[model samples]
Target: MKRYALQPLVIGALNPESPVSKHRQLRAILRTHAQETCKPGDRLPPERELAEYFDVARKTLRQAIDSLVEDQVLKRVVGVGTFVAHPKVDLQAKLTSYTEEMHRRGMVPAARVLRFDSVPAVGNLAREMGLAEGTPVVRFRRLLLADGTPMSLDDNFIPEHLVPGFLDDEAPMSLYQRLDERYGLILQWAEDEIEAAAATVENADLLKVEIGFPLLRVTRHAYVDDNLIDFSVSVYRSDRYKLFVPIQRHGMRPPRYTKITQT
Candidate 1:
């Protein structure tokens, strides 16, 4: 409910003679002002006031603000003015559950089990799980949330025989934990492929983002002792999440030989 007053120094005329377009100039100035003066959750001045201060038309001002909103540098509520956005989460490529990762970031993780049922595996599902066609597989469609905000939509397929009673109502937040505790199936490793994607209507509704919004799709195959346990596809909000991978150089040395006199 707190409001932030725009800084007076940001009120200046745009350079018309400059090569940059008026909207682009306005956007750059606003971006700098927001970065320098605005704190996260600080509401920006009203659109009319910003237009007047920048000496630009409302439409031009709107275009500039829209760019920031798309970049997640600013957030606009219907009635409330725009506010600076919080930092995006950096997700590491690790074999940890979503709940564990969120908890490590000091965020409360929650999951809504949208769909949980057993279905016959075919095509890629069968091949990925190394199961015969028509094998019964438990499918989980879940929406993952962090601090009550939608973060990702997960669709997972697991061999049903490996996880008996998993579709029951009393399901744990962390499926890996459940598999380890109840089925003694340890997840030793996983391979993940990450790519950019657009949010589909169904996923956008669950994630609370606009349809066709930018998203990050992650396809994963988890294993236990070289046996596939589950294959999952997760779509994350690109504006809210960033994938991080750490690389290290492997130390190697060519063969070194000493002359016979060195003995």
Candidate 2:
């Protein structure tokens, strides 16, 4: 019977005489509580205690909590009760490396290289990288993580000439940084096509999500002096990351990048 600090804010706030619906009011109150008072993983008061305090039925209380859960502000565990949810990282359309972006978000980023090898470029990949068919390409698959939690599964393809001697042991955490320092290849810009898809069994297994879970699929084509140099496809856990376009992409402060200092 530990008391939740948020319960004080909720007391006497469900004005039944107010024109607003009680459930809606309660939902707003809870949202405010979450933003102003609660941190991620903070346990909410039991449903029965909250319902009794609000003088509303359990159904109304549940309705309010349900909306917050759908919005990703709250999470429910069976037999465990509700808790504040960890914030989702927005996939901002900024031209920064994943390591740099994760640093900006105050999360540690790492890559677990699942597969790495040189292969012949096929029809679409050859055309995409502006290379002749059957050209040697270096392809690597990696499980990308933030704070040790799997966030994305990636397949990065590059013309072998672009990254000579690139091996699994020397795979870079910040590809952009490696390209700059090791190969002296300055990345110009990249274009991405994003879509939603269901996770495959392999993707589910690697990302630690249930099979058929929703994922954000991003295909990127990177350039150097207008020459396409790299093509990569990344599948991100939708529950952990959501994509967004900023009102202004340019003139923003550049990220403090994380270098390829780890194995």
Candidate 2: tens digits of C-alpha lDDT, residues 101-219:
78987889999988788999989888778888899998878999988889889898988987788764577878778878888887788888888989999999999989999988888
Candidate 2 lDDT score relative to the true structure: 0.81
Specify the highest-TM-score model's number.
2
lDDT by residue for model 1 over 1-263, one digit each (tens)?
01224546464458989999999998888888778888767888899877777767999999999999887788898887888886676566667777877888788889998878999999977887778999999898899898888888999888888887887757578988888889999889888888899988888899898999998898999998888898999888886877655444467553342111100
Cα misplacement distance, residue 58 of candidate 2 (Å) = 2.1
Model 1 misplaced regions, further than 4 Å: 1-42, 46-82, 252-263
Off by over 4 Å in 2: 1-25, 32-49, 76-83, 246-263
Please, what is the whole-model Cα lDDT of each candidate in the order they appear? Answer: 0.80, 0.81
